[model samples]
Target: MSKTILYARVSTTDQTIDHQKDQAEAAGFVIDEVVADHGVSGISTELKEREEGKRLYDKLRHGDTLVVRWVDRLGRNYQDVTDTIRHFMRQGVVIKTVINGLTFDGSTKDPMQEAVRDALIAFMAASAQAQAEATKEAQRAGIEAARRDGSKYRGKKPSYDREALGVVVDMLGQDKGASEISKATGLTRQTVLRIRSDPAAADVTLSRWES
Candidate 1:
């Protein structure tokens, strides 16, 4: 029997495995199992390195469906993400995303469809890596500014933390409404709006608090 499994990486307290599962279910995926890695940095750890992530390789069968909140959940970088997707597809596993309802099937025999699927995978993987890099850069810059300025850099603390900010940024990128992001992240709509209005400032706020 082919089953659908949802994989999630919960790196912080703000993000929950249940929330991910719920998101997948809401997106109409009849998930048979859920695999998640807690306290794992998606940017630092490759998917195969994660404890539960490794389980995915063993648990998923040829016809099983692999579901994720986004393509970024599969790996840490562009190369890693693309490689992982291709590897799974080669094994006859179908990959799907809850966010965009995107599907990648290796069973497709059409040459044009294969080309389009490969292109889309490449684009999404690159985008995931780009977003990760941008977040890292913003944090580095914020930390440097905080260190140089000391107490002066510490303004009123942001209601949301680094992880929350990242979630907000991601939802914003997905074109989610401020109210929806606020409800999802447990942040106020005003905070979501503020982050939406000035993400760099939000990043600096989070970094200042971290320092």
Candidate 2:
């Protein structure tokens, strides 16, 4: 008997997979095998790079139906998502989503229906990618404006501050270790270590960033 498989991913580990499973079940998918990718950010990650995501690639065969919560769970950008979906469709894999009840299959005998499906996939994938880029740009602009004005931006103290951590970072540049910097600044060893590791990247954070 052919099986119906479900794949679910949450951007953060804090979000439980149960919710996604619930939605899939509510949508009437039996979910024979569930491949879950957790604590992985979809923005910077490709579907195939994820552990469970990779499993989906290996397990799925021609004529197998793959169900996901959404298309975004399948990829990072518009082109990647569309390409991945189309590749699977060509291989006789059916892509199904719970949220919108969207289904893509390769059994279409009508040229018009295939064209419509392709267009819809292309448009939706582009929209998803554009939305992700816009969100990142907005966050960056907000952080930069906050930094220039010295206004509190993300609710609590920033995780990284050039003004305060600069000295420690500079000391590290002079060959200071995390322990030495931690002792000098009265900061935790982990914080000092992180600063030492990514000083330049850390230096751009706002002072009011929340954990």
Error of 1 at 97 (Å): 0.1
Instruction: Give Cα distance to truth, residue 40, candidate 2, Å.
Output: 2.9
Best by lDDT: 1
The residue ranges of model 2 lying beyond 4 angstroms of the native Cα positions read: 151-211
Q: Candidate 1's residue-wise lDDT over 1-211, tens digit each?
A: 9999999988778889999999999989998999999988877788888899999989988999999999988865988899889989999999999998999999999999999999999999999989989988998899888879787568677788778888999999999999999899999999899899999988977887787
lDDT of 2 by residue, 1-211 (tens): 5567888777764556788888889999888888888777676787888888888888888878898888877865887798889888888899999978999987898999999999989987887888888888998998888778765554445444555587786888799888888787778889888777776656555433522
Clashes of each: 0, 2
> lDDT of each structure?
0.90, 0.79
TM-score of 1: 0.72
